[model samples]
Target: MPSAHTKSPRAASRTPLIEVTKLSKVYVNDAVETPVLFDIDLRVQSGEFMAIMGPSGSGKSTLMHILGFLDRPTHGKYRFLGKDTAGRTDDELAIIRATKVSFVFQAFHLLPRATVLENVMLPLLYHPTIPSAERQHRAQAAINAVGLFERTNFLTSQLSGGQKQRTAIARSLVTEPQVIFADEPTGNLDSVSGIQVMGALEKLHASGHTIILVTHERSTAEFADRIVHILDGRIASDSRSHSRRSSSGLTSLK
Candidate 1:
């Protein structure tokens, strides 16, 4: 019999944006093996906001890395946008990473000396095919999307924690990627600033961006349409959120 992680016929009817089956990861040092993930199966549809929640050392970040194409699983299968990724070369993976997926880490990785516009435009520098004028236009649009158009000229070092995060988000958006992985996006911000960052993410989701967020805070996880709980290197629960979303706004759980 096929494992539970295998995609069902019904699920196979519609193409998933991301898929994983019986995925596992392990690290070996001096012949000592330490396992981090075990027998994981998951799927994400386009334009869906999904959150993976777990405490530190629960393997949530490792799962995110695998899903984001930053790291490969030691065993099992991973498919991105319907393409199996098992034997893809590093250059091929880099191309997919550059064109299909974007990531935002807890620590803002912006260049301190660069202006917000310049930082946001960094991703486009990799694609020489895109004209300089088009690159600037996309960068400006992304900055505006994150509500940072006015601060485009401000140096990243001069920005607040919240503003820095928004700039990072803008950088992710400059690529117009199909999938975005955010690892503890609000981890370093104050409550108010975190709310602002969440609001930006929510707006992005509303506009049809597929978002996969990893967070420890229930309040932050509540923003996603679905939440998956991870425990001891395995999936504990996966459920759709009941939070209300209307034209007015999201009505989070009390």
Candidate 2:
């Protein structure tokens, strides 16, 4: 039997940026335990675009939360950038989450009152290491990357749904994170808007940013180089897409 940390032979030479081994999560209240994720094993290489697809109750969001360091797993190992996160402190995890990983959500979690540029600069506030003067430059570059430069001075409320999503993406990029976790980025947008959002993400991927997307829509998942299907808290299938092959032509999630 394969161990919980198993990887395909084809991926042996490449180092995984994020590795999850026998990972599981459970919610406990009043001494009652509810398992939300099974013994999940996954490995994501740097610069790869991956999508996690599952129905409403399949635990995809739970998995993303755990992987993104927003929540901890009840059991198993989660290694980020080759460091095991089993006993890390919350502050340590927070630093890693803030600096190395970024997240975009379905709700577009932007401050309605803030301008698009301000919202994009929000992540830099937590990153004290970035010089104050450099923050604006980075934020502006991020907004431009998402094609929202024209709306940077506009209040977030003034932007369209697609532009709001772009601002969210811009905020995520302000930190120049190594990985991005997007949960239903286009969930609230129309088909055309969703396509634009996906296009922005695809452009990011082309720029060598690793992305993990969680979506129920097959059309959205099609943007990923590889897709993992989850069913009842377990991975049903992990496969590469013929339409989005990697540069090496060996993108495999086994």
Candidate 3:
């Protein structure tokens, strides 16, 4: 396991966009306490592509939850863009998540009755700072980026599996967040669809978006620059790849 203080010389010299120290999470039910994560320490530089991989019950999901700010840790500290998240209130966390983080899931999670454009515009509903016209413009751009501009008027249910997932990706990207947390993004798609989705993600990574992917698939993990393997609530390995540059000059493992 890598310690916060033991970063490689290359890593030590860089400023981290996301940092976690001694992170742990425990679930308790009826006085039965089970720890889902141990003392995990991690640092992700801006625009880095990372994959968090593990077998079932290895606490990868728990770690993802923590990383996404969807769940709090039992102990340890999280700092985002140099701000400590340890004592932040739920409202504060929500604000941070809304402005800084975006999420992609295996399930499209689109509103079945909504058009592709409308679904992509969902995040803007919570952002009072963006004017309606700007929201629409950004939404259209995101949809276009995902190659779904032609289907913007079609309901999510009218699309094929890959198209639906593409719409979902557009929605996540609509926010223009600093970080994207994706959990099994290709799990529900066929091989071809998965490849298309991965290609889309690769484009985003190239555009300097920080991405953290949670997956069990080796092939999927290979898309990232760095791979962090977890097991039994602990980190097993953190490996880097050779092809380390994204299109935007973002570092990748391989």
Give one digit per residue, the lDDT tens place, for model 1 in 120-235: 99988875466778988999999999999889999999999999999999998888899889999999998767877888888898898989999988888888888889988999
1-254: candidate 2 lDDT, tens digit per residue: 22222234545566678899999889999999988899999888888889999999899999999989999999999998888988889998888887999999999999999999999999999885898899999999999999987898999999999999999999999998999999999999986777788888988988889999999988788789888999989999988866752312222221
RMSD of each: 4.0, 5.5, 4.7
Model 3, TM vs. native? 0.90
Give the candidate order by descending lDDT.
2, 1, 3
lDDT for model 1 comes to: 0.86
Better of 1 and 3 by lDDT: 1
Spell out the clash pairs found in candidate 3: 225-252, 225-253, 241-253, 241-254
> What would the TM-scores of all predictions be?
0.91, 0.91, 0.90
> Residue 118 lDDT in model 2?
96
Give Cα-based local distance difference scores for all models: 0.86, 0.87, 0.84
Model 3 residue 65 distance off true place after TM-score fit, in angstroms = 1.0
Per-residue C-alpha lDDT of model 3 across residues 1-254, encoded as one tens digit per residue? 33342234565566687899999999999999999999999888877789999998999989998888899999999888877888778998888777789889999899998999999999988764677789889999999998988999999999998898888889889888989988898999987677778878888887888889999987788888888999999999888855542322222322
Report the error of model 2 at residue 12, Å.
Answer: 3.8
Q: What is the lDDT of residue 253 in candidate 2?
A: 27
- Lowest lDDT sum, 10 consecutive residues, model 2, at 245-254
Worst 10 residues of 1 by lDDT: 1-10
